[model samples]
Target: MISSFLLPLLLWSIERILKRKQFGWFIVIVTLSLVNNFYFAYYQLLTGLIYFLLELFFVINTIFYQEKVQSNVLSLPHYWH
Candidate 1:
């Protein structure tokens, strides 16, 4: 239960310290943790699954939208006086 809350924060801290994006770690850790929850009680498994999906959606959306914005900016023409 505690791991579910802490892993994201741990990943975020690692990314921040390294000054690099770490989506791969985020996906793997979250997926495994959620999958492990299924071995426990039913309620924990259900809530963990829901939370994992929501977090995955949010992370994926942020990555896609951020890339889209970056691409648009890069494609814009530069002006010189």
Candidate 2:
């Protein structure tokens, strides 16, 4: 029960801090946990899927938003010139 929740968070946190760029892989494993739930785990597929998708969205938003911010920062001086 608890392990299911903790496992994904552990993976996501490690990837987020270490590789950082490839944190999407954490989402993939968590998504697989959706299937794992159906095989007698305490949670349901919907719960696992929802959690995975939420985490995936957060990771993607972080990466893409940082990219946009960086590009805008780079372009700031160009607009004045």
Candidate 3:
């Protein structure tokens, strides 16, 4: 039930993080994942742990990829129009 509500917000955060390179959106995603872990922990500890780990992995990879992309862009020579 609550997951449904959070899904869109999570997607939005991912989009914003990728598009704007804002660290705040990444923090929001982490917060949301933690909240989800707590919410599911009451019912199933193993499931919650698995979900949290997966989310963490995804967020970390996204951050690393964003950093790599930004570095690559900065290294490229720019031409004045």
Candidate 4:
């Protein structure tokens, strides 16, 4: 029952920790959630992914594709390789 309220905070925390690159907490939260219930764990991550994409689109204030791809240019080689 309590999970209903706490789930949003926990799910959003996944985004905060990830946005800041805290992999340790990310793993801990995901593992803890997964251990409790698979359905919840799935929803938590699913919700987090949706929130992340929404935030990504809204937070960026760019008009050109070049601007968006500029920062990622350096990492493209690694991804391609």
Candidate 5:
């Protein structure tokens, strides 16, 4: 039961690390969680990983779509180069 609290924190830290490049919180949480309870932490790590993968997918999708839009319709003047 107590181990459940780590899930949210681990997920949040993963998000922060991805969005803000903030590794300190993630590192601390991972270290503590692993040291305190490797068994439960493993599940937490898996959930965090899934979240990270989803975020990466969306981010990549958005970037590609944006580039496609810009390339197809938004032509820049030659002088801008």
Candidate 6:
């Protein structure tokens, strides 16, 4: 029982360490893992899908925005140099 709580906490700490370089993907995986484990082992559905959906949206937005900026940079002359 105690390990169950400790497990997610440990995974969460690891996820935090990787946050800046791979923010959304890590969060999604960790959150989903926690949700699955807790649900299957403890029969608890903690945390709402709304928050997950928001994280997904933010990730998508960030990717799209970055791509747009890259494309704009490519369009400028001498950008490759």
lDDT of each: 0.59, 0.61, 0.61, 0.70, 0.86, 0.55
Ranking by TM-score: 5, 4, 2, 1, 3, 6
lDDT of 4 at 13: 71
Which pairs clash in the backbone of model 4?
Answer: none
lDDT of 2 at 50: 64
> lDDT value for candidate 1?
0.59
Per-residue lDDT of 1-81 in model 1, one digit per residue for the tens? Answer: 655564555446445434465566555655566566644334544554566567678878999999999988877765321
lDDT of 5: 0.86
In TM-score terms, candidate 6 sits at 0.41
> Candidate 6 residues 1-81, lDDT tens each?
443464455445444544654455445555655656655433322332344456668878999999999999889877765
After superposing candidate 1 on the true structure, give the runs of residues whose Cα lies further than 4 Å from its correct spot.
1-40, 78-81
- Model 2 vs. true fold: TM: 0.47
Better of 2 and 6 by TM-score: 2
- The numbered model that scores best in TM-score is 5
Over the stretch 43-75, how does candidate 3's per-residue lDDT look in tens digits?
Answer: 343444455567678989999999999988887
Q: List all candidate RMSDs to the true structure.
A: 7.6, 6.4, 8.9, 9.9, 4.2, 8.2
lDDT of 2: 0.61
The global Cα lDDT (0 to 1) of model 4 is 0.70
Model 6 misses residue 44 by how many Å?
Answer: 7.5
Instruction: Output the worst ten-in-a-row residue range by lDDT, candidate 6.
Output: 40-49
Compare candidates 2 and 4 on lDDT and give the better one: 4
Clashing pairs in 2: none
lDDT of model 4 at position 66: 64
Whose lDDT is higher: candidate 2's or candidate 6's?
2
Model 2 root-mean-square deviation:
6.4
Question: Model 2 shows how many backbone clashes?
Answer: 0
Q: Pick the candidate with the highest lDDT.
A: 5
